[model samples]
Target: MPRFSSDGVDIAYFDEGAGDPVLLIHGFASTKEINWVNPSWTKTLLGAGYRVIGFDHRGHGASQKLYDPELYHTRLMAEDACNLLAHLGLPRADVIGYSMGARVGAQMALLFPQAVRSLVMGGLGIHLVDGVGLPQTVADALEAPSLDDVPDAMGRTFRAFADANKADLKALAACIRGSRQVLSREEVGRIFQPVLVAIGTRDSVSGAAAPLVELLPDGTQLDIPNREHNPAVGDKVFKEGALAFLKARP
Candidate 1:
């Protein structure tokens, strides 16, 4: 684990394997290991001859914690990714992001398009425009004194997951708050890079795939049949679809 200065916060990241670079951004309440390693994402990318890069966003994983909601904006997280690339001396790289990470990836393509060669946005769909899947209730759960205090099922599940991960609850609360910011349809359409939007057929949080794909200049969707958000993270369909898209990029 290495640390770097991103917008004044010390962010932790991993750079492994070798070849064309592929940056991996994990989802909400997830670290690089949980999102990439446990799911074999690093293995998949490395086997495809890609240099894998991953990092903990502010307030998540081993990164510096920030309790301010203003600091948790996905745009700021996107900047952290760009800065990580700058730190690695990579002008551009293929990018993959799941759940919360997908929003950050979309922001990266929107705000720093030159730094993204191609984009794979997973665990996300029309939610990019319709508003974040989870409501303010999830944020409230993170701020609750204990998981038991979270009445909402989805909120409780996220709170428990955060607890299991030993996450900074207050910081994560802020993350959930600030991360609710959404990209407009016009903004999403502006991300002209070849994009693959992967989501599970059974995933309700991600919303519909067709609406998102309709906005991008070069976007396609891959639905993992009978899968949901959590289980779809490392699905072979997702990995294979992503690898194929990357290979097809000129």
Candidate 2:
């Protein structure tokens, strides 16, 4: 429930446990609780002797909501993560992010490498190199007055998820509107930190993880067979891979 100012917006975050810090950034339409706590990420990391830090991205969860499309750019969201680390007085910390959060983490590595010790990107893949894979219709779904009218199954699912989370639909639509910027291969190659890209083999939303891993200087991939985007959020394979990757980080 703690909050900090990130570029004048009050962002909510949680800090728990003790030892080396690991910052957890949730995906689109997700709060830290749904993305991290519900999956036992904090408990798992805490048991492993890590201090767990999780936060609600601006306009998501308990954070201040903004209707402006400009506020949701991936770069600004990455700044929020860096600001959180600074606010917590951690010079650098291991980071794990899923879906939209994965892109935010990638931006952090590209823009604020000094504050990141290692990176684990989940629910991301080749689509990351092009742009956010979801279409504008998906954003429309978030703003739709009723899910019954959303014809696309994917859009309906995302809209339903937003409704279940009681999210700010307008803010999420803006996030989708503004977060179209993509990471070039050269930009990804600039990330020299140990990195793990985890995705589900069946996740159509993410494309393939191999292309993304190939772009990272020290990247590796973990594919959770039979799982899809939402179900793959905190898969056991992802957790194990992340633990090992962080443990082996130089």
Candidate 3:
């Protein structure tokens, strides 16, 4: 397992193929293997002649997990990504991020515009700025002893998220509650790179991908009918649409 130091944390990442670089950022409570490799996203992009790089975010996967709430901020996550790219000697590369990763990607493009060649944002919407409504009750639940009594209402509330299993669900809910900061739309608009925003029509979290579509200065939106967030990554419609859009751009 390859690793690097960034933002006072040790990060784990995977590098494969040999062509125009494309970085893959996984979602909350998801590792690079679960999001990209397990879905064969790396194979799809690599088969199309693009190099693929993926990493596990802090507090998830093989990366160092600090139980500290402050360390999981989106800004720090963004900085970790930027620092990783710099450490690898990559001045610029295409970025593909999903869910929480998309939020981080947005910050990356905003804070380090020159370091990003293009963007493919999946499973997220303008709610990053409009707000996703993480309440204090949810925050308290994260620190609760044993989630055996976790309410069904809370589970139903986050059903749109990928992992539906109890442990995965609890951990994800905790992460969201612990790290609740909104991304700025004004900052999102500042990104000038060609962006491909793909959303699953059935996506529970980012249901209104249209609003996010409108925010991008230069973006193409694709809505995959009958698909949910996790499945969309492997959906033929989604993959082809993104590849075509990326290939057409400089």
- List all candidate RMSDs to the true structure: 0.8, 0.9, 3.1
Worst lDDT run of 10 residues, candidate 1, spans: 130-139
lDDT of 1 by residue, 1-250 (tens): 7899996899999999999999999999999999999989899999989999999989999999998889988889999999999999999999999999999999999999999999999999999998775789999998888987889999998999999989999988888888887899999889999999999999988988899999999999898989999999989999999999999998
TM-score quality measure for candidate 1 = 0.98
What TM-score number comes out for model 3?
0.87
lDDT of the candidates, in the order given: 0.93, 0.90, 0.77
Q: Between candidates 1 and 3, which one is better according to lDDT?
A: 1
lDDT of 3 by residue, 1-250 (tens): 8899995689999889988989988887668988898878899999999988999888777787666566777878888888888888888889999888888888788888987898888887776678653455554454455455446555433442333423344444456665677767777778889988888999876647778778779877888889987677678887788789879989
Off by over 4 Å in 2: none
* Overall local distance difference test of candidate 2: 0.90
The residue-by-residue lDDT of candidate 2 on 15-119, one tens digit each, is 998899999999988999999999988889999999999999998999999999898889999999999999988999999999999999988988999989999
Worst ten-residue run, lDDT, model 3? Answer: 160-169
Q: Give residue 91's error in model 2 in angstroms.
A: 1.0
